[model samples]
Target: MRFFCIALAAASCAFADGVGIAFPQENALLPAVKRTYVIGAIPAADATQPLTIAGVTNDVYKTGAFIAMVPVEGGTNTITLTWGTNTLDRTFRVAFPSPPKPAATNTPPRDVRKDLGIPPDEEVSDARPKGKRIEDLTVMIDPGHGGQDTGALMPHGAGEKTVNLLQAQAIEAEFAKYGIKTVMTRTTDDEFPALYARPRRAYAEKVDAFISVHHNSTAADRDPREVRHTAAYASTPNGLALAKAIQQYVGPQVTGVKNAGAQMRSYAVCRNPAVASCLLEIDFINLPEGEDAALNDADRRSRIAHAVLIGFLDWLFAPDDGT
Candidate 1:
């Protein structure tokens, strides 16, 4: 039996022959909840034998991808996967969240803003040459997670992958109104483009900007009802600017959710150095309200799509700090 342990987010492990777990990295600290998902793949050569996790036989797609929601409890949880003669074991820790302390009634409201040392903006001059027109610019839209990788599955609604594609299509349609050209990484449900390849396609197509759409999911221990927000992420300064712009426009348009703000994270899709790239977590799909809006509310999705386009335009036209 091969054993591995990891704790960082988005970590994955594979054996020498390419069979391995792709998510929930080994030695992860999870919420004290009843169940969590395990995503992995096995070699096509071993297709004749069944792939079992914790003794439960899972149906592996032709692409070898498989995802299973498995039972987990508080304390140390060990997950074992068996494919033919190969056995892999991953360990995780589940802990309940500590209760929040009561707030003091006498305490005053706090100012949330802090100094980010951003330079003052310069006024645009009519003499300055006009930049490229919106119609001349091109954007690449990537719908995250597809095929056997279902992303975060909602209890009462469509999976994250499905909603991601839907929102991407809506965004594409909204962009069309402005004559802005848009290229999609995948337009169908069955397409599962490689994570790294998504950005490469953007670079090859010479897109001015890249946006990856996705829904967020919390650990099992957290109450989905209490969590509702939209977040954006990027790895570079330019990417951060784009992310912040998206957060500004997309957050408020989603009626019930709060703006969680932009963050710096090195996601694979957001690492495109050729152009500004951002990954948008439009909403927490695990929540019923969030899922409902994403899966059922057509107007809400269109509003979000328009907001995102506006955010992109705002960022593109903003005066540069000359960093």
Candidate 2:
């Protein structure tokens, strides 16, 4: 009986070959997922080396090794592993619990304008047509595509407008954290104001800068391969500086997403009241390769959103950064 037990133990060890994995994968999930992945073997041994873990966040990685998988988002996905020449396969399933959204920061108790030497434009800045210049500046964020207009729709029904609004909200939260004055075009699920009206409100409020958040869609005939790229359009000629800064910062953060560069578009806000203005068409819409899903993902997309906010603030305070 002892010898039989020993033989069984050795057999079990010999067959323990591989494992599988998914990405954005591990723990903590969000509604949007970037990609689904499969990792075949962990700690692989062929002509021979030890196995190492490989994934987006994992520190360890090996060419032919894989082990254990934790789900980040989406439903329970199964990974099949085939072992060696015999082509034996093993499967495992995991539950993916949705990660909680980040909490929004509360408004500061006091405004920063008091220390900046410029008077606050409080509501009616019409009296001072010249506009106030503060050490810190005020910005208005407008999210394009709202209400019944779904903008562009992906195969999975991800909407560009929805992404824009969410991106706008995430950026505003960050701007508030830095004590910059901010005005928003619309906050809820209401119809967006007409194109011309958007900048009018910003100009009326004496906003220092106006940013319009939107997504651009390309025609399938020309872009059959489903191109993914980031771009910015400036109404004011001077606003190109802001556009370039945003493209430089936000583009790399999105990874595989391309940069269309700072483009010049004659927009409604460019000629309005001399306030600098820019429009950002984040990426091509309804891309077949889950581009919308990637942008909608809170973990990754929020980083892009935060980057846009940082680019503007960085431009405002550190224009001398030698872009």
Candidate 3:
């Protein structure tokens, strides 16, 4: 009897190998906005037993698979899957959504011109560098997403990868005119490197600055045309300065693009400690106008490229900081 029990236990272990929880990964941070589906593959040996998950009985199919819609409340929720004596479980957090801000008022905004302490007729000084040159600087340009990763695909069939490569190429061309050396993470549409690998190239090349180009997307319910903004992101303080420079120049150069300002974000490419880095969201690709400006129009692409080059030059030669 003891020898027979040992053989049965070994068989159970082999069957357990086929059982797995595929979705709502172990110790995952799940969004609390809506109920999520818990999907998994069940072993045929455990198919006869009732599968209890978080007090709910889940129905398993003959094909040894199961899918259940689980309501996730805010805070930690322990999910337990049990089939007879064999059990599998995982703990995950359902984060609380941030509170919505108050709606904007209809009143006209107050003018802050009085706070400038300058006469309205006085001429503003030129912000561009006069004699500074970046001939010795080497910049690394990253065109975000490519190949299998077609990021932010619009319903109209526009892909962000195409625009990213186009913009990166144009930027490279403009930088060459200033005698500044430039390198790209990807020069073609079919090449896609891992996220960390993109910034690692900058360190390997010993470049002074890194910029990743990308386009923006909106929620499914919102109309893309209603929201068109140009934004820049950086992780470090020096990177923030570069982001600000890009925002200041590229925002206006893109014609219809609204200046969303520079934001500090800890993105993978922007977190490289060895080089100053920023990610530029040139335009919203989902919208018709943005699609025309960012991808379809050659003149707009050239203008944006020139604007980015000018922004980098401004950052490199800013009188107040040590670049």
TM-score of each: 0.62, 0.55, 0.59
Collision pairs in model 2: 25-72, 26-71, 41-65, 41-66, 42-65, 42-66, 43-51, 53-60
Across 1-323, the per-residue lDDT of candidate 3 in tens digits comes to: 00011223555644343355644556667765456555555575566679887679977755455655667788877677777665666676777887877998898753222232334565432122235456767889999999999886532344689899999999999999889899999988899988888776776676888999999876433445566788999987888888898778887656567889898997888876667889999887654455556666888888888889888877877877634
True lDDT of residue 66, candidate 3? 64
Instruction: Return the number of clashes found in candidate 3.
Output: 0
Report the Cα lDDT for candidate 2. 0.54
* The best candidate in terms of TM-score: 1
Superposed on all Cα atoms, the candidates' RMSDs to the truth, in angstroms, are: 12.9, 15.9, 15.3
Better of 1 and 3 by TM-score: 1
State how far residue 80 of model 2 sits from its true place (Å): 31
Per-model CA lDDT versus the true structure: 0.73, 0.54, 0.72
The TM-score-based order of candidates, best leading, equals: 1, 3, 2
- Please write out the lDDT profile of model 1 over residues 179-229, one tens digit for every residue: 999999999988899887787677667678899999988765555546668
For model 1, what is the C-alpha lDDT against the true structure? 0.73
* lDDT over C-alpha atoms for residue 59 of model 1: 71
What TM value does model 3 have?
0.59
Error of 2 at 22 (Å): 27
